[model samples]
Target: MFKPLIKKIAIRIKFLRSLSVNHWRYLFRNLNLKELNIILVSLGLAATAGLFLSVYDYWALRTPAPAEGGSYAEGLVGEPRYLNPVLASANEVDRDLTTLIFSGLVKHDESGRIIPDLAERYEIKGNGKTYEFTLRSGLSWPDKTPFTPDDVIFTINLIKDPKFQSPLRNSWQGVKVEKIDNRRLAMKLPVEYEPFLENAAVGILPQHLWANIQPQNFLLTQLNLKPVGLGQYQLAKITKNASGSVRSMEFSPNPRYHEKANIARLTLRFYDNQESVLGAYKRREIDGFSLSSPLEKEELARSRSVKFYDIKLPRYFAVFFNQTASESLKETEVRRALAHAVDRASIIEEILKGEGEIQNGPFSFNLLDIGDPETIYEFNVEKARNILEKDDWKIGDDGLRQKKIKGKNIKLEFVLTTTDWPELTRVAASVQKNWEDIGVKVNLDIVPVNAVQTQTIRPRQYEALLFGEVLGLNPDPFSFWHSTQRKDPGLNLALYNNKKADGLLESARQESNLPTRIKEYGQFQEILMKEIPAVFLYSPNYTYAVSKKVKGVAVTAINTPSQRFENINKWHIATKRVKK
Candidate 1:
């Protein structure tokens, strides 16, 4: 049996060898050099075609998928002084950390809409005077302590306390926050204020940890340096230099965070000023830096790896006419002429380096676009001159505009007061030149910001105040344009008082429905345009330089610099490829 099995195996092996030799011999005998060359060329072409197809297929089949891990280093201008949410407002570096390490009940999204952050949902009740928020389930602080209504109450009460001296005290002055239950909270306002919801966007502190600290020791406590909250990131490590100044702050994704942070680690390095910040970026020590100085734009342009994002801030700079003080500006035709005389495009190009948007009205949110189309003003010198000439204003021999009305000669002249910021100074000078070209005598009074605010603005002494106003995330015109606020403390620099305008502003402030509020604001904007109370100029853009490595950074109408971090959890430094 063993012999027969061996013979069978040998016979099979011999048959396979003879078949291979016969096949090779047949191919060699049947083929010629010309045929062989054709075959070789066909084989080469087929191999090359296959290689190309595979290369194309590899790239075509891949899709960018967000990877879970990477670190991002950013340079900040100032050192972290107070990481506590209550006191972060005083320091930008502190605010930067607090924005990442603390979660607010409500937050302003990238589009400037107020959305629930820690709160699962919120409802406006009682004529928009009350806001009730329900905390999301499973919410916990960085220390794994349960986040409840008590934490929200603790934060609001601490801000309300006069001794705490929080910068956010003014925002929550007349608002009362009450605990509804362990997972629910209610904030009641004394008056109907739709923008009151914005105040609740402040980050909440853990009641369990902060309950023991006295109000006097709030800023002095060690916890301010190592705060624990329900934010996207938690403090992992703090590295300091020899002088005890914080060299860098390293943060890791919080396990208890409601949303997952794509960036595994975020490191913020403190610098003395913007110069140092830019230097670190040039050295490749940092990947991102916020725009602080105009000169930084040029430096950012030089770096090929850096990308500049033009984020339009919620602030608008304009020439606010004090019609009560300036007799020439009292005439509606003269104010209209002045509005059309100055070129906003030129101002944006020369002064802002083309880093601004032409502001058509007080409401500067591009997303809102609430202003009426008929209210849009254009720079037309001929139209402005026609408006002025129709009102019996004539060009004097002194090359200045003069008018004779009511047996009195009124020259088209007024001193424009503004702060001595480089941009403001240039803008004022440009305005002066434009008005002078239209045969109107113009003067500029540039003063220190503090002096202008205390002496000129507070007293309403300036003929025209060239200033900027931040309308907040939600553009509330009640504080800036309401007739009630036209006095010394009022922001109504134009002293504009119209009953219809006042009603629209009040209704818009009370209207919780977004579309109705927008319609009301649009009507109010029409009145402002018809009245020409303030010459709306341009809104400056918040320019930011970020490296190409950082992804998913999208900024919209940012009321404050800290709000840029609202979508910080979405920013990722690493990525992978997967199926679509």
Candidate 2:
């Protein structure tokens, strides 16, 4: 049997080797239908198996990677005034531009954690009073100029100088900077402030470019618009209108940057308002833009080309009652009644379009990891009325509550001042109606966005101010709630003064241990809630709208809107396949 099989196989091999195209075709033509069908099925199966192997090999070995070419255009609401980091604190546009064009010794990552940027590493010394930083090796500016510790020293000195009038001056008041060597420097604070790292995130200016400029001429210099620094991107061009107003600015990736960005070009277009920015986005003139108000969300979401990223920010908007501006608000029960009467959930739903979280205290629960107080001022109209009645506050003939204190008749009426922005105005109206529902008269004082700070906040002219406070990543409540920060230029909007609260804030600032600091903040919040200095409302989400073409935006939480670009270098508009 083996001999017969071998002889058959040999004969078949010889016959196949001798066969040609015409012979095979003739042979197939003579075969039966069943044999022909079997041959066709075998060929089809072999081809399918080959294709499956090819695809499996491809997918198993390749991955998608960010490619280094593409352009991105963003629409901003304001024109760039001063691109210098020291003076950019006042203008959002300036802050956004400076963030890309400048680099600091240290920077915050997408998670709001402090990371080294220009500095290679840092250490705390002198019992946490001194922070010593070592600069990264071989760092250079866009113009190929070497960067050193002197640049950091110069930037801090400018911020400390009163003539510069930098908004950052207050933070660096008691800090002293010393250059230890060409690549190392140290900053010594008056006290061991745990939040000093946040302050160190300020952008560093090129001393060689700014040293010759006088303080008076600082705002007029051309360098403000065309800056040179050690950031990921550098200014490439600026477009202006006939009126000499900047209409658009373009930036190119800095080759000298530590890590090159994937996007080759970045363009920012300026508009007078959010409407114009939205219009430009709808017209496809810009690839991405941020929303200033939640009202535009529905309209913008209708577009299929864009996506919305709702980022949680460490901020809160509240109604701060000035005890000195109104006599009725001086009483703790009166303040508690006002806080209880106002419906925070309704305001967030109607005014914010359900885009915000109802805040109960000054601190953010998500950011600080602290539990809410057991007794929150829940929305209860009857309860608010009962509290006022118990405190000797009676409803007068005008349908408003009044109380006689120290032989003086004080009506429970006060003005609620806020910016004329549509959202804030609506919030103020809703709050006013809520208070009025509980027999408390509330007057709405809507002022322009520019005048609200200088005219209303600085002078403490309003009895109650509806404003927002943006806290840093560390959430230091000292500046917003401390007694020392009550005067002009101070952020203590309620003019709140409590010795125990002040001690808690001061101690919290100096405490580096996370658990201890959190405990101190919890105590401070309890005191604030008991005193009722401010009626905490809600924390709104920072909505960033971008085209679906852009990818790699992983930031979920940010201290400020500008910090959304913390990982900008990783964002890309172009992609390529590479080995996994």
Candidate 3:
């Protein structure tokens, strides 16, 4: 039967060939047999290749390129100084880097509650002062080494060193971190700490690798820029300049990462300002960086192809008045007068341009657990002049506020300092003019943030300063206001001292109940309103723009906001072709 079928097919092919020879002459009278054969062979080869490629592609779809899902753009004002979490000098850039390259014992939930990360679970011992954390089984770093509590101990010891110059020195001042076993750890603090886990901002380092290297000396080492950690991304490649600065880095996902990350490769491309960075984003040069200035937000809003994410962060921007002065700002009336002089309302609308609401005080305005809207001090310049007159701060011959103190007519003229943060610069100009309107003269001295913190703020050399504080996950105000913080090394920028205010701060930290805590905080603000050490300003809104190609972005409080990226495994890029 098969032989007959083959003979039948041969007879039909011979008949078709004879017809095709005659037909080719009819269509192309001058064509040769060789030309006709070439056309048929070419057509047959093309059809066979098309069918083969389609089948090959069908199989190719079964195995996709490693979890690569999206693209994004990040803007920065300058290059990051350090990548080590313990030695990270610049935060705005380091926070993004840390979230990708490092892991901590615990992470902050969207609601600011502490949740386990590298640590499986923790128990409260010593009545809330001591916290014993146990590492999760199978926990491993990007390099596949098992994680243990000694890593935490190594981190704490490095910060506690007097000369290492860790930025977190104040937070871990009297705390003791010790490894109990291979998996268990204990943190002992001098007093009850309500936000004990908030210290998780200190990303755990590998004890075996970093312990022997002195942090004070390691900052200049080659390993500082190329450090390893237990986060989703590992430093695959780094390019440096002649001066030894990391110019760019390409990060690859860790194969042993606890969970798979959506991104296959994350490349950090740095630039000098938001303008250059935005240009890179428009050209698709970078994926996933921050928008540093207000102008960057405006540009992102105009670009229809890009997506902008604005999460209200715990970072608060405002001006502080120095009260330790024996001259112009000595009286409480003078401080109240200065507070009411500025127009933070207009500044927020014109300068901030997004979701930041006016702070009722130094707490979250939309927090379900705390923050009262009624406590915000209203802007009133009319009330400002009244306070000045009561303090004998009459308009002087030179038109600045002046008064007789200790037999000298001390004119209210002081220097204000700030980083080149654009928003702060504009507000400083506005505040300067506002004080001038009320007959108080001010001189503006804007400089690098490093200079301000180290030279100006630390020495109390400047009379006042215009800057912002990155609020921590916990709501306690003790670190900023307590007399203990008034030391030059502490966050006591304002140098405010009120025993009653200190007591209120401690009370807020101890009380876990919401109602009594709210009432106490409310009363505390009511008292601070009268005390007026620093003029609280409006909390402005900021947006972090991403390329529309990426997804899974939500709001986060500024302190640990990028903790949102812990769920990076869930995000995916659209499979559609990217639009220009």
The candidate that wins on lDDT is 2
Query: In terms of TM-score, which candidate is strongest?
Result: 2
Residue-level lDDT of model 2, residues 126-210, one tens digit each, is 9899999999999877677899998999999999999988999999998999999999999999998998998888899989989
Residue 101 miss distance in model 2 (angstroms) = 0.4
lDDT of each: 0.83, 0.87, 0.70
Candidate 2 wrong stretches, greater than 4 Å: 1-58, 365-367
For model 3, the stretches where C-alpha displacement exceeds 4 angstroms are: 1-73, 89-91, 110-112, 141-144, 178-180, 242-244, 365-368, 372-376, 560-566, 574-580
- In candidate 1, the residue pairs with backbone N, CA or C atoms under 3 Å apart (3 or more residues apart, or in different chains) clash, namely none
Candidate 1 CA-lDDT value: 0.83
Model 3: per-residue Cα lDDT at residue 399: 81
| Tens-digit lDDT track of model 3 for 243-345 | 8776777777766566677766667777766667777877877755566666667766776767666666666766777767546766778877888887877
